[model samples]
Target: MTRLLIGALTAACLVPAGAAAAPAAADLEITIRNVLPGQGELRIALFDTANGFPDEPASTQPTLRQRADGETVRVRFPGLPQGRWAVMVLQDLNGNGRIDSNLLGMPREPYGASNNRLPALSPPRFEEALVTLGPQGAQIQIDLKQP
Candidate 1:
């Protein structure tokens, strides 16, 4: 019994402190404002890189599709690695799973990006909408724009 106890203690001491502890995950809370209630559904995408960015939802690590039931909607993404992230949200009024645009290449649906940035005569870039998330997590608000 004493030998077993000593062996267990030795094994525990061999492991470094915090080595057995799991890495802290980041939680991102996004608040989308000015959503068109009862329009259609809100397509939200979270991107970790500039590959797809504000345009491609399939390139995102995780995407969310929810109904636009209110003027303001909150979505929380948990268990994400601590790093930079960008969020793109659009109210799909047509339920066609894509943003509707006009003949001039201007969006017809309500859309918004992280940091509430909407460039004139251009689309929002991933870098401009990036939000840093540490172990402490982050919260951002995006206001929808009607073009």
Candidate 2:
């Protein structure tokens, strides 16, 4: 009887607080503002790794393609795991699926990154743009930067 009680206590101690309840799905809602009022598509990409950050959309974990009609566009990524994530938005003004850059490698269209982080020389790093998402999820607003 003493051994059984001790084993039970050990098992309870091993279980973390709130372990009985499963964690909620992490959802992320991103609002892209200051978009040029015109006909275009907003390409939003979510990255969980530093492998492909703000510039590489194809390498992102999940990509969201939405229409850019008004001054702002909203998108949501649901059922995401709780972790650090960064977002990148590109306003394809020419309806092109990709961001158009000039000869000098400057973006010709409006673009934005999570946490509104912008780099002076190169694209924003994942660390600079990352947001911690919890079980309750999070909402982030990014302002488009026109060049």
Q: Which one wins on lDDT?
A: 1
TM-score of 2: 0.80
Which pairs clash in the backbone of model 1? Answer: none
TM-scores, in order shown? 0.84, 0.80
**Model 1 residue 39 distance off true place after TM-score fit, in angstroms:** 0.5
lDDT of 1 by residue, 1-147 (tens): 999999999999999999978777989999989998998999999998888777886643888898999999999888888889889999999999888898988999999999988997888989999999998999999999986
Global lDDT of each candidate:
0.90, 0.86
User: Per-residue CA lDDT of candidate 2, range 68-103, in tens?
Assistant: 878977889999888888898999888867788888
